[model samples]
Target: MSQTPPSCPASVEDVFACVEEHTRPLSVEAVSLESALGRVLRERVIADEDQPRFDVAAMDGYAVRADEEAEWLEVVGMLRAGDWQPQQLEAGQAMQVATGAALPCAGLRVVPKEETERTGNQVRILRRPADTCIRLRGQNFRAGDQLMAAGVRLNAGHLALLASVGWVRPVVTRQPRILHLVTGNELVPPGQAPGPGQIRDTNTTLVAAFLSEWGLPVQSFRVGEDEAEARTFLAPHLTGNQPPDLLLISGGASVGEHDFTRSLLEYYGFRLLIHRTAARPGRPLIFAVRNGTVAFGLPGNPLAHYVCLNLYVRAALQRILGVEGGLAFAEGFLTEAWNPGRSPWETLCPAVWKLESGKAQITLLSWQNSGDLTPLRHANAVARLPGGEQPLSAGSKVVFLPTHPL
Candidate 1:
């Protein structure tokens, strides 16, 4: 039986919970460490061996007994990086060790070259500074120590750490197959000059860039306003063995006469779970599913698309990638007095923020309406303003989410 779509939730946070119930993590695969960035790690990465493998010098200095009372010690040997020579250091002896060279013995201190004067065969300890410039074995991590837990998203630093532990090919959740359809006869490509009653489409580039943050690829196309033709164009994709894992249709999500996203998804056997949201600019958002594939019908307004993509669609992608937990909102203080105006619904306003002395200070940007996209250029974060009429003063605490791609 076809399921009826639910009514809009009272809060934007509930919308996140509704879509999360229908999705699960995609299958996992083994990929090279180089290609693992932005991919959620599926296995526990442990230290293959003690990090550094041995006691190595942190810098070029003389390795000597910390309590050596010799006026001048013999230069036993010169050790460079990758050279491991274990020679016992007596009370009157020292080793000239280069940066990253293995220490000859324990109970030794590294006197920096700046604090010592070296002669041809004998070096004089001009000053015996109490400093140990050695990177001890197991200091960073010990053998079998858990370096990364499952479900951690791998970044460049995480990849390097994995490679150092011999994880050349790490298992990660596969990225979802996304099919994007832009619906509207009045929409034209960004390069083309728009005629009367037509506007250039910006949702394609916007959606692509957002997906690239997680290294996911999107297949995009334009479907006209005619519901029948749009169904015919998308019917094959839902039937084939390699159907998209997630479907996104830009525009046609409202209650207008031309809005057909809800009916079209039903005809394709998709169960509409959500038809609207309680957030400003993104109220007409649609979330549906067919079997395991998730779908979202975004509003035609450019800013609405941006807002929905950042909030709801992002939540779905997180579940599919096996990233644990829900959408996290951080607290920030407002830098200026502003108001999103009086609205019964939650407002997801765009803003720019920076950390000052470890505290987030936000400056909310303004927009004429949901159709406005110019303000997004200055927005690096999204601020959640609860329904109220009072203007927020400077340094008022507010919740926000950073919109960084990485």
Candidate 2:
């Protein structure tokens, strides 16, 4: 009989530290600016040229020499958007200029379209002393200035900025290639009828969706049956040329006779950093590394596996891809009292926040069960309360990780 591994402190920080110490940045990739969103920056992106590259009009108006009084003159030329050449504006002369058009000349003022009377080749100044609405070159940014620093996850705004800065293709941190293996003898895919003593494999689907949401890439995902079948299926992947940066195993982490993930790791010479943690729902978590890939063994419970991944694995994967804190964390007020039970690891539960008459109040979700996923549907923040803290009271302040706005 195999002896069960000892349980250890389930501090989220300790788990993260272990992950950080073992993982390294993945390779870099050059993708088109249009598709760079959510990927980490492999290198600092400097401004290629000043935004607006030249003095440009900010509105449709008459381009005139601010130093001269122009009552009327021939509109010798028309400047529209994308017109790069600067036109000479002589004294007593005005040119028809459109928004985003290059300034007719330096020291020129603009008479807004609403403030001017326009005829063929001539414009009457309806207002005076209005300086040219010229956007100066490099006003937004200068060449060689850092536009986006390395290790930042790109967003839609970043993509627009990159395109505006004239980068067709930019270097970004390569996607983290991962292999997911789900093991169980009594599990079937969703939508399939389960036989006696069998259930649907919800963990597999949830894990896939979670990884996709994290912006990481998956190379392969296979379902493993018994020990022999699992070992055989994983053999080729372990020795393949393109080995995954991380190997995540779902289920089969317990000491059941059918569970083979732990034994398989030992057979392949992996050093397991953590075999268990004193936490609810996901106590049988395991982490290991072999050769260079980080291997993980998550509990079979769907909710528990997702919680562990969110609290630890996701952050670690981001760090491995050279990303900073995976997401943002904010502070909120506890609306009602909270009572934390004894556990080595802190529990992160959903909390809803609203204005109570005048003050802000945060309350736990309706379903707080470890096996329930309904609570997440209404959860806006993951409240972090100390494991051994005294019973929390209303109006107490707590730090929480906010959910990304939809």
Candidate 3:
């Protein structure tokens, strides 16, 4: 709280620093791996025992002494996978083993059954394997080995790895309670037909969909610009023992007469840290904190909401989960020419970044204004363009932030 500048408008980097300073990792909890998807891990996943603990056959073949020089050998026994009776194989003896069957003894080579002609219990060797064809013990991993480190976001593959080690439950960061309220009397439900001087509400749907990607649950509502109406919706979450960890207020972040986001935050014991930012589409950004709860006043524009959610708000979520990197920026080259108008602040141009010919390529989208929602459906990234009247040509190197999964 004290580290944040109260009056001055902050740059993107300055705001990032302030958020990092104020944010803290949330508490940890143990949950089954089945329910751990999309949750950040808080503990290391260690191997309980050696992988491939026993030497087993990698193919279906005859287990014979590697040094055997005889043209034919006696098939003493047949061993399939899960049958672990081991017997020493003499120079003239062979044991038929299925794939994944343990080797009868050391110094044994597996000759694939396809290379041998078998008649009842007797078999004739048509060819010999060049190698042992055996998977050695502890080949994959050993006991006590660190398979996965902390701060990892769990996915299907991670869960599978945990299951391989018999670790059914993993410790991960608890999901934070998020509350979002979109203010503006001019906003109407997307389902309802709008009257004159009003538009359908898209912020609610956008915010809900954005948060759903992380598997986080959020309670969102469209409240009137009046403080009393907003407080009534906030009463249930505020009066209870468990209050929202993060609160987002969309629209009214500016300095208009109805712009009461600042006043609303102050009235709720939240100390304003940032009033605005030096970034396009998100200049009227507001940030505040009270106790351990964090709040944001997001610009009502559809594109601005998209930018702030994926950029700044995502950084706060990462900090709360102890993620290693705060905000990850990827490098790409422009696939098409871009004529961006000049602006004093950096512009986060909606773009589509995809792999083409093994190269990261970005194509900036066209939007009439900041409130335009046309480009969002096609944008998978946000190109960070430096402020100027610079025209970006095709194949120009640019740095971008991925909005979708890499």
Model 1 lDDT per residue over 1-406, tens place = 4487665453686777777788999999999987888999888987879988998888788999878888688998999998878888988898998888989888888888887888897988888655587888889989988999888889989988987888999999997899999999998999999999999999999999999877899999997889999888997888989899999999999999999999999888888888887778898888888888999999989898888888888888889888877777799999998765677777899999899999999998899999999999999888998776877789889999888643
| Winner by TM-score | 1
- Model 1: how far residue 223 lies from native, Å: 1.2
Sorting all predicted structures by lDDT, with the top scorer first, yields 1, 3, 2
Candidate 3 wrong stretches, greater than 4 Å: 1-6
Q: Which of candidates 2 and 3 is the stronger one according to lDDT?
A: 3
Per-model clash counts, in order, read: 0, 1, 0
Candidate 3 C-alpha error for residue 143, in Å: 1.5
Model 2, global lDDT: 0.74
Clashes of 1: 0
Clashing pairs in 2: 75-121
Residue range 1-406, candidate 2, lDDT tens digits: 2234346544566677778877788788899976787788888889877876887888888777878665766677788997766667777888778998888578777778888887877778777754557787788998888988888778888888888877778788777678888877778879899999988887777777777776666754556566777777888888888777888898878777777788888877787777776555566788888767888888887767766776667766777778755445566788788887655456666677666676546787655556677776676566777767577888888876654411
For candidate 3, the per-residue lDDT at 372 reads 96
lDDT of each: 0.87, 0.74, 0.86
